[model samples]
Target chain A: MAIQQFEHGKMTLEQFEILLDTLGTNFDSWPKMKQAEARNLAQTLDGKRLFRGAQKLEMLMMALQSTPQSTSQSVPESSSESPLVNSAVTPCDTQKEAFLEKLADIPRRYQQNSAHLTVCNRMTLFVTQALAVNSDGSRLFSPQRLASQAAAFAAVLAVGILVGITPEETPTGSGEIDLSETWFVASSDFELGE
Target chain B: MPNRDKADDTILVARVCAGDSDAFRLLVIRHGARFRMLAMRFTFDQALAEDVVQEAFISLWLKAGKFDGAKASFTTWFHRIVINKCLDYKRKRQFSALPDGYDRADPAVGPEVKLAADGASNRLKTVLSALSERQKTAVILSYYSGLSNQEAAEVMQMNIKAYESLLVRSRAKMRKMLMAEKDDLFAAFA
Candidate 1:
């Protein structure tokens, strides 16, 4: 039936290649019609070459699976290791142990991050409480709350701008010198000298 | 069986999200070795593979909340993470020296003889490394790691048809490369 389809122009070489890619080179597992069509196609020269290439690919993958894994060596397996890990039977139990040892610190580090976040959260909570129109948390976004939040934001932005524009100065033996003021003073002194 | 694994993974992930380290440990123990093997296929270095797996699991720990089991299986999600780490590692360390005490080919022995003696797996690895990263990934995901085409496509973030097409092109390219070394490969095998 598939051979007839192929012969009748139903299955093109491109479509056959798609099937070959999707279904692999194995004809036996294909649907009966496709199996017949594919087997018939496989007999042709182009089909033969395509099938051979797929077979070689399968063989290469097989060789990879059978290859002696570089990491597989005779190392004692630990008791806590999973059977899935050991099923590969590679001597990676030590590596797994190391991973788990590293994993042990995750919660602590996570808690530390949580602690850091908590401080920020507490600040946010304080500001939120101050902005709250009601203690029961109703009307949290009331007009007054918005005004307060806006004012807080504007104040913070103003402080940031101020800090950003302030010129940095080095403390000398006498004390910190204002470079801008010193320049202005020297210029005035030069004008007076003139 | 897969359903049970999925359920187990879902629960474990939920626990990890709840800050349960023991659940996270179990998850690592169950999947770490296989993940390492997958990484090794990409890096070809045990230590590098370990680092890739470490980075992947660390991301898993830090971003457990991002995973949605309803949309995709945990394994598929984690596979994407590992593959991304492998790709990132490859990009970061594009140039590396040969391992210490590496054996150079003998002047007396022909290249063909040397390749044959190294075995088909090694020769195939050489050919695979010569392919583009996507092609290499297509081969590794489909064949070495035993993922279904659909699953591999999802892991690669490509459509199923595109993944299959990539596999076809990859295999064809590998066959061409092997044929060029036919004297070493086909002759020895034949």
Candidate 2:
């Protein structure tokens, strides 16, 4: 069969428009199999694939950005033995506060990792939760909280990596301890000592 | 709610993968309408279509980490997800027969018709229904979905030449159907 191929690629604007009209008008009688196949094709060709590298970069950036800043800086430097000593801070409250503080640092770390990772405006809630937990002064920062914080941060970092965004290297001599990683070491050491 | 068009899908997927609830919301808004349309075609019911779209978006949030640009376009991959969900819906409907009915009440005749003001679109839909499944799919992908023949072939899992043949046959059938309809309408009017 001598099938006429419409030069869709090279057609002038007017020609394209005409072709569009013709195709549009005739689309209804297309075979059922063809319609299903075309729908499938249309689904595939509409947009560019979401790149893994870009996605990873984005995730990492968000995680870092959502982390809370260090409480040692955010809290007032009082001469009191413990800021919560007079305030009747519960262990749970202290833990929450510590978690929040760690969470706040995430964004700054993300910035250090990559300038392209912008703070998502709505992510403040998660950051605030991280901060709020630190300030509560009830529970001391628990291993679980730290783990969650680490997981969140890791998830974001993974996204950054996926999206081909080179995360800024961890700042040298930032003096901030990675509590999540340190906790495992401390626990293992304590077990060995016992 | 995040601003539409401000954050791209790649960024949103990244955020969601990073555990950002807000980023997921933006994705829902960005692709919801398109997903809904795809679902509607597959399920033939508005409510089921909505469910399919929502489920597809949720899955997107969970699996955003798996997205790789080199494998396929985001839209295409997402469509595959939506289609799979719709297929699942079809299976469920077959067993339970969902309450919603797909009464043969003209699927494509809607607000767009008011804008066109011509009988062209209605005629098109009628002709589309007349086509065999594969040919109909080929025609729709080429004409409406805006896929290249090669991409359409890939989606259909067919050889390029076979896809070409399908398109040719589909277009010829559509041309014949439309001409016949026009003749019948003119005869009736006369």
Candidate 3:
């Protein structure tokens, strides 16, 4: 059978992937200049998934504005505190303030943690009990208890075994053992008369 | 947009590294949708994708200062974080549903087929259902999610050559499947 050639053209898979990326960018309305720049930038990154150099620089700019600046420099530092220490403390304070501001926006985090803690506690308790039972010799489940149940079963089995081993009586009673005759034969009076 | 252009990722990383919570939110808003789509392709569940996006953003915040532009693009760095989170989610799900295969097919195909035929988007989903998991992920990430082969490879954590193979196989499969459907349409016309 002849192999059918699809019209993928002379484009390599990488080129096709890049074209697809360009289409996506166009769909997202990235500016013409930015798209051109991004295409050139993508060429450098080649095998990498990240945008490097100026493109990264551009993304960094947008990220910075969205984040708030700290203004804790106005606070007076103690005599023991170094200027470096004060500067470091300012950023931390700013972050804490920002976190508190956004805390109300994330009610689900608290709910999820609480629910997780509850489940974890219950599982921990169950595991502890299971471990305790398996560890302590006296408290551990006894094989004897299981064997006692088996012994009751064995007693019933022994009765069944004895019944099977015993000879059945014939209608003529030929196979029957006569206990009376055996007892009389054992007696001394019959031997003395003889 | 001008304000965005002036601010820069390094500046944002500086702020975030210094522990600026709002900086992190900005990062989230900027890349959340792309990350979400990337995640959705991998997991095929909207809710799980959202969680993956959130986790990715959180890790970005925690590790902002560690981002070195000299090594890679900020976008690449950010996506690496997202992909890892998705992989972790897959791993946890694997352990939780051990022995039960995780194929995403609907159990009630009869009802689903009717539902699928009613809408164009649903029809796309039905077509996507016929693909292998890796092929589906590769195609969706490349076409729908707007990732380049390199980017998709990074997300999938596969080598360039391997990723290319996956893309080739996936595209070939899609072409075959779509062509079959087209032939059926032509037959009906004839």
Candidate 4:
């Protein structure tokens, strides 16, 4: 496929770079259709350079992963292997047996966890219900409270508008002098006002 | 074989969600080793890795009911759970005296790691430590764990494109840093 794509020239240099960056030079995990294109690109001069960079980064990563194990407890032999650790996948029959021994307790453990999950659900429901209900059995989100909140909000909005519109002092017909509100004033202006 | 295992995982997960502990055991035996491997890659500490696996299993037992087969395979969802635990452990132990989670994961390391330690790795870690936590996590989950960009994004709760960009930048930064310390890395790995 890579050869086919290479002969056909299916991808551009920029697209090739994106593929290199996103999926790396390995076409193993790319889409079936795109793998050929990627592999084809990887063999190119630019692609090889990018691949070398990725390979170096990957090698450094391998070094990071090769940390010394500090634990004393014996671990099951490494049995699961992927394409990356091609040479390392070995059978761990003893580990399988030890693991099987622990398998029996899972039911009891799951039961305990299920019970715990149930308790948590019930507690959550109770708390939510308690929060939304008044002791008098009226809902906290009752229409009456909602209407009162709306009215309070409207009153606040009206006061804000009045303050905004009447930022300067005004004397009314009743001879009542209104003081300027400086809540929204700049600090310097407020200081000058003081 | 992988497809069959994945199918079995789907079945086991369904049963576990329905409160079948037996199915959960099968799930554990089937996936536990792989989970441990992932945890080891992230944390390096054997006990800590074990804890991560345990917490992930417990979460699966409790939350499997929420799994949506139509959306993702059990493998991907479970990946999110385990990686979350790994990252959680990493965050809680963020300021440890150890250079990285790798150090705290083990007290006495093998010899090869020690030889490299005095050279490029320490420098590499210094550059890595300078990265944002999410950036470092993205690299680990993608590069070391071998997750796809999409799967890595799912695990980290980030957009796929965002995760890819993060990996790109992290790798670019590493490339730059390593370029500067070429001789040291050569000595370390040589």
Score chain B of each candidate by TM-score. Answer: 0.84, 0.62, 0.63, 0.74
Q: What fraction of the true interface does each of the listed models get right, in terms of native contacts kept?
A: 0.15, 0.00, 0.00, 0.15
TM-score of chain A of 2: 0.18
Where model 1 places Cα greater than 4 Å from the true spot, the runs are A1-22, A30-50, A68-112, A115-194, B99-118, B183-190
Question: Residue by residue across B1-190, what tens digits does model 4's lDDT show?
Answer: 5554565566566666667676776677556666766776566454577777777787777777677655777778887788778879988875344432433322344556665643445555566766777787787677556567787888777888788788877776765565555444465554
Where model 4 places Cα greater than 4 Å from the true spot, the runs are: A1-56, A63-106, A113-194, B1-3, B95-127, B157-159
Over B18-120, each residue of candidate 3 has an lDDT whose tens digit, in order, gives 5554554555444454565566556655557666776666555544545664455567677777766766787787423211112333343344332322232
For candidate 1, what is the lDDT?
0.67
TM-score, candidate 4, is: 0.52
**Model 2, A80-103: lDDT tens per residue?**
223234364544335433433333
State the lDDT at B146 in candidate 4.
Answer: 54
Determine which window of 10 residues in candidate 1 chain A has minimal summed lDDT: A70-79
For A1-194, candidate 1 gives per-residue lDDT tens digits of: 22333444456666676666556777887667677778888899988777776666666666566544423333223325543343543233444556556644566565423433345444443443443345354664677768999999999999999999997665776656756766577567567553
Q: What shift in Å separates residue A84 of candidate 4 from its native position after superposition?
A: 24
lDDT score, candidate 2:
0.47
Residues B126-170, model 1: lDDT tens digits? 878889999999888877666788999998889997887788788
**What is the C-alpha DockQ of each candidate?**
0.11, 0.04, 0.02, 0.11
- Candidate 2 chain B least-lDDT 10 residues: B181-190
Output the better candidate (2/3) by DockQ. Answer: 2
Of the pair 1 and 4, which is ahead by lDDT? 1
